[model samples]
Target chain A: MTAILKMKGLGFSYGSRVVLNGLSLAVEEGEMMGLVGANGAGKTTLLRLVSGVLKPREGRVELAGVDLPGLRPRDRARLVAVVPQSPSAPQGFTALELVLMGRNPHLGLLQWEGPRDLEACRRAMELTLTWDLASRPLSSLSGGERQRVFIARALAQEGRLLLLDEPTAHLDIGYQPAILDMIEEIRKETRITVLAAMHDLTLAAQYCHRIAILHEGAIYALGKPGDVLTPENVSAAFGASVHIGEHPVYHTPVVLPLGRRGDDG
Target chain B: MGLARNRRPPREAVHPSPGARLLSLPYLSSHLAVALLALVVIVIVAGGIGSVYIPPLDMLKIVADKAPLLSLEHTWPESWDTIIWQIRFPRVILAVLVGGALAISGATYQGLFRNPIADPYLIGVASGAGLGATLLLVTELPIYSHGLSLLPIAAFAGGLLAVSIAYSIARQSGGLPLTTLILAGVAISSLASAAISLLIIRSDPDVRPVLAWLLGGFGGTQWRDVQIVLPYLVPGVVIMIAYSRILNLFQVDEDEARQLGVNVERTKLILIGAASLTTAAAVSVSGLIGFVGLIAPHAVRLIWRHDHRVLLPLSMMVGAGFLVLSDLVARTIVSPSELPVGVVTAFCGGPFFLYLLRRRGRVTL
Candidate 1:
């Protein structure tokens, strides 16, 4: 399979401190790639590098064989769309208005969103099941509803790749699996490449086609979910013990957190 | 944690047709029309009010007489025509220009900073211009101004300098936090204001001119002042309108806006430059008219919503109308003995802002 996203010797630092360094990975087209790591393990940093929010100080990032770092922001946005960990918009904007902003990159500076742009927004909103909420104020929506609306916005960008940072963050159990299911459903039809930072390792194991474990600013392990999510790897990367077992129905890894080296459990 | 996607059933045929968006179009335009109409009405009525109370209809005719297409019979005294054309009209037009410029500047700053309470006056641009005007006045600087006062050019440079300092002070790790920016602006405003006070005290034995500068009015306004303000105001407004879409994207968090392909840093710089230029031009002639900036845009947001496309123009019209009325009240409320126009705006705007702050703290910085 051709790789849709490729990173080689990527390095990013904040002042004297390093957030990601010498990181290299390739995500295949039509595949769901999950980035899993603990706090400060560089999961979000890697995603930001790909989305062009933060530039790599050292190496190259290419999306579909085109250089990402040098492209102007408007051009880069046409290639990839991102949903941040906690998505927010200013008050008084309706869901339709927020979704319409996804068309911004496609538009000229003075150009207004015409009928065709609205049609694209309509289709995107329909896929995410946020069509009915178009006229409603964004602040009036519930958490799950808001998540769907933001996903609709990302989808409306019409980018070739979708990057989601902490897709299940701030979501309840019922909504978490549903959002993943919906994303899978959307992917099945659209065939858009997805690279998501998953805070919940089990959800990552279930949803991602392949998983990578980020450790100390590099990919510590990369393979199929069942191969890469062994108990030893989780313990090493996270600095804690996890009892890894087979998920009964899906035959994926299910991780249960245990206390670290010396804890009062 | 995987489950069937059954949480939200496919919502019924609730997606409104394209007409849904098209429907809101007229609603916005009608409000815009109302604002435009209000401004026209206020300008005409305000021209008629003041020391000489000409009827609003006669004021309309006198204005129409100036237009080449129509010439009505000369009904009133020639001095009345002089008052309408030479004296009152120029002053009123200056108020309109100042008010509209200030409002647009306020709306632009608020959008860029992502705060509702943000305005050029609150963020030291006005203070900087005040200092610049004083510097020009005190030092009697020889500038090669052709038909333009040297004060506005100096004031523009000063205002730009102040905002640049505030922005740099607040910038951290390539991001400007709202709280830090506000604090930095407050500090800079204090410094510029102190300098202005010192210049006022030390430079001039007669305090009237300095008092006029501090109070901010169009008491002796001429058409030349209006002409000097135009070159700055026009291009600044065009840039603001051109960037309104990018400004909408900015309402989201910075990272998201960047991800959506907005060049955040460049847009911020251009918006700040244009807004400051506009603010300084208004301050140069009008002398720090207060709160028209804050009140006008917020009022527009109340009637319509936060879409800067409509917000910018409607705010301009509303601000122009509001200030013309305010100046009318300022000059006529005490009759012959007039209050400074800034006092009128401050008195009206101050309590209104306090009410906003108290009403569930809606007017947030």
Candidate 2:
């Protein structure tokens, strides 16, 4: 399969602090990959770079094998869909309007949302089970509902590659499974590639086809979740020792962190 | 075309849920109808009201009779014709255009900065124009060459220059940070204000006229002044109206705007440029008219929802009507001598502004 998104030596920095250094990653067509990293680990920064929201200091991000920075906005958008953690929706926007925005990449100059765009938006919202609340303001929705609305927007983009930064960051447990399950189902239905940064290791391990653990802005481990979600790697990345056990139902690796001195609660 | 065709098959075959369908639809036709009604009302009331207080029927007849070219001149008394044609009509037209321009530009600025407080004059545009006009006054330049129209051009140039500087500085990176723009605007505005002060204080004489200009006035606008403003004002208004669709997208999120193939930076530059031109032209002709640009859009948003499609045009009509009504009062309130149009607008605008502040509660920097 052709690589839809390819990053070469991607590096970013703020002031003197280097966030991503010579980070090389590739997302091929129809792959669902989860990016697991601790706080401040540059996962969000990587997403921003791929989305062309931030210019890379050193390195290149290519879409459909073409160089990213040089491609026109329309072309880049046609190739990639991004859910930036939680993007701001200004006042007066409904769940439907927000979703319709995903179709913007496909629109022509002077062409806004036509019936076709609306249809795509409708499909995305329906797929996410958020069609019922389409007319409602985004602010009125719960965290889970808002997250699904954003995902629907991404689905509407019709892009080959999807990049999400901590999509379930602030959601409750019930919401986390429901939202992530919807994403898993959408991937199966559409064959759209997804790269989501997940804070919850067990959830990431369960939903994602493959896991890539990012430690201090570099890929620490890359493989199946069973191989990558070891107590040693988790401890090294988070500075806390933890016990890893298979989830009873899902059979995914679940981490239970001990105290800083390695004592159980 | 290829992309559109490619998208049609899967999208149509795959039915979207009814809930999603409701969200994506654009209600332009209905919005356009409502906006048109509001505009008609604004025009009629604006033309009809003044100290002379012409009735709507007579006002219509007076207007129909005097409209040039087609010459629909209704058979009205000469005094009424003079009142409608020469005085109230022209002033009302100017007020509508100027108010519309300022408020539209204000809407543009607010979207550009993503802040409610961000008016078109947020960057030193207003102060820069004030400074330029003040300089022209203190220097006692050959006014016979250009007449009053020179002030608007000078102000336009100053406003354009200041905003360009602020925009460039704020967008050091490819993106413009909202906080940076606000800070830069404040910094530039203060600089312009200080320069205007120095010119006022150090001038040999003519300081009072300069002060009056700073306070804003629309005392003696003639057809000549209207002609001077039309070239910039008309094109500027058209550009702003055209950009309203993009402004709607921009208000959502810059990244979202960019993804939809919007060249966010370029779109923003065009908007800011157009807004600055309108403001400079409006300020030049009318003097330093305050609050209409800020108040009109906010009022529209409060009454209606915050959709730029409606907000931009309504704000324009509201602004124009507002200034015209205020200008009418400015003339009739004291009669004979007449108050400066700016003073009346400020009086009205000041209270509205306070009400907004009180209602919204205080926003800390």
Candidate 3:
């Protein structure tokens, strides 16, 4: 399969502080790619670069043989859907209203949403199991419910590339798997590419086709979950001691943390 | 990105209807209709009641007579026509336009800043305009020439300057923090208000007219005043309405808004400029009317959804009707002499504003 997203020597800096440097990778058209990193490991910064929200300071990205950052903001948005971590849920707005804003890229200047736009949103909400929360105010929803709503919004964007930053961070045990399974099902059906920044390595190992571990402004390891999620690699990336096991049903990696690497224990 | 791709639905399928799309919605239509009808009735009531007391039926006939090819036999007294047409209509129209201008501008600011409590008055926009108008009035510069009024121009420039200063001062490394923005606005407002006081004190004319204007009312408003405000108000309102959809995106996270195709900085500048212009135009005529902007948008948001496509128009309607009715009470409640319309608005609006603050405690940006 051909790579749909190509990043060549990408680098970024927030003023004098470099966040990600000399990052290069290719994402195939339809695979689910998990980005596993600890806090400040530059996962969010890299995702922002790929989504064209933050321009790369060193190199460039190309999506579908076109320069990503060179494209207009609306054109880039039409190609990428993002579920930002900890997005502010406007209290006065309802869940459906927030979800409908996903259609912003496709809409023309001054255009209101039509019946078809609403239909697209409804389909996304149904898939995410958030249709029931449509009329509820965002302020009243629990964190998990709001997280699902945000996911639904990303789904409603209907872009080819989906970038999710902590998509299931606030979700419970039941919802975590259910939402991941839904995303997997959709990706299989529609061939949409997913690049998700995940804090939980075990969850990443389960759903993602390939896992990339980012450490110190670069990818330390990138391979299939079985190859990349070994104990040494995980310990090195996160700087924490961890025992690696296998899932009973899926046979993917399951990481059991042994606490901080240099703690008293 | 591919010539052979078939991903998004065809553009025509998702295209919004060409005209008045919000009014045609099944759920919102009835409410919009009611608001619209209420505005019509309020206009008539506001226009009809004065010292002379022209009836609504006669007012309608007089208005119709002015229309070409609509010659109705005049059965009313001659002076009644002058009272209805010359004196009353202009004042009522001024009230409507100014109120609508303030409400829509307020909605624009509230959306752009993502602060529910934001308004023209709260952000020091009105004080700036008030200062501008005070400067013009005190200087006795020729305000009207070439069928345009320089008063709104001066006010618009001054208001825009003040808001830009406030916005820049409020800017942090991350973004515009709302608390800082409010603090800056308050600081700017006092400075401008102090400047106005100095100007009036130094000029030392009959301070009564300036004081009357400062307190805010529509007394002695001429047709020329309405003519002056339109050049700024109409375009300002149009720009805000056009930007309403984009403004909703601002309520979302700014980065997400950018990823969703909004030019965040550009949109911010445009909406701020438009809102300030509208506020300046309204203030130039109505002089420091407070809280109609705040209360009207709040009422619409409370009763209806917070979608700005719906919010903007409904707020304008509510504000127009509310101010016309307020003007009615201001002029007639005491009879002969009038209370400032701003006083009436503040009487109701002050508690409502307080209640909102107490409930929300801190409005997050």
**TM-score for each candidate, following the candidate numbering:** 0.94, 0.89, 0.89
lDDT per residue for candidate 1 within B26-138, as digits (tens), equals: 77688878888888889999999888889988988888898987879999889998898898889999999999999998999888888888887766788887788778877
**What digit string (tens of lDDT, one per residue) describes model 1 on residues A1-265?**
8998999999998889898889899999989999998899988888888988888999999998999989999999999999878998578798999998899889999888888888888988888887878988899998888898899999999999999999889999888988998899889878999999998999999999999999988999999999999889998999878889889999999988876544755
Total residue pair clashes for candidate 3: 0
TM-score of chain A for each candidate? 0.97, 0.93, 0.93
The DockQ ranking, best first, is: 1, 3, 2
RMSD of each: 2.6, 5.2, 5.9
Model 3 per-residue lDDT tens digits across residues B137-226: 788688766867676677766777788889899887645665677799899999999999999999966888678777799988889888
TM-score for candidate 3, residues paired by index: 0.89
CAPRI category for model 1: medium
Local lDDT at A12 for model 3: 90
Q: Write down the DockQ of candidate 1.
A: 0.59
Best by lDDT: 1
lDDT tens readout by residue for model 2, B1-365 = 12122222454444443444432224655655676576656666666666566677777666565557656545556677776667666666777778888888998888777778777678778888887787777786754463444666677777777877787789965567767877887898899999998988889865777777787766666667677778888888888877776777786678777765578888877877788888888887777888888888998889865767668877887787777777778877787777777788788888888898898796323
lDDT of 3 by residue, A1-265 (tens): 8889998888899999988888888888999999988899899999999887788898879999889888877888888999888878786777878888888888999677887778887778766666767778889987767887887888888888999898888777877776677778778876899999998888999999998898888888999999999888978888888888999999999999885553775
Q: Cα lDDT of model 1 overall? A: 0.86
RMSD (CA, angstroms), candidate 2: 5.2
Q: Where is model 2 more than 4 Å wrong at Cα?
A: A261-265, B1-58, B66-74, B77-83, B146-149, B204-206, B358-365
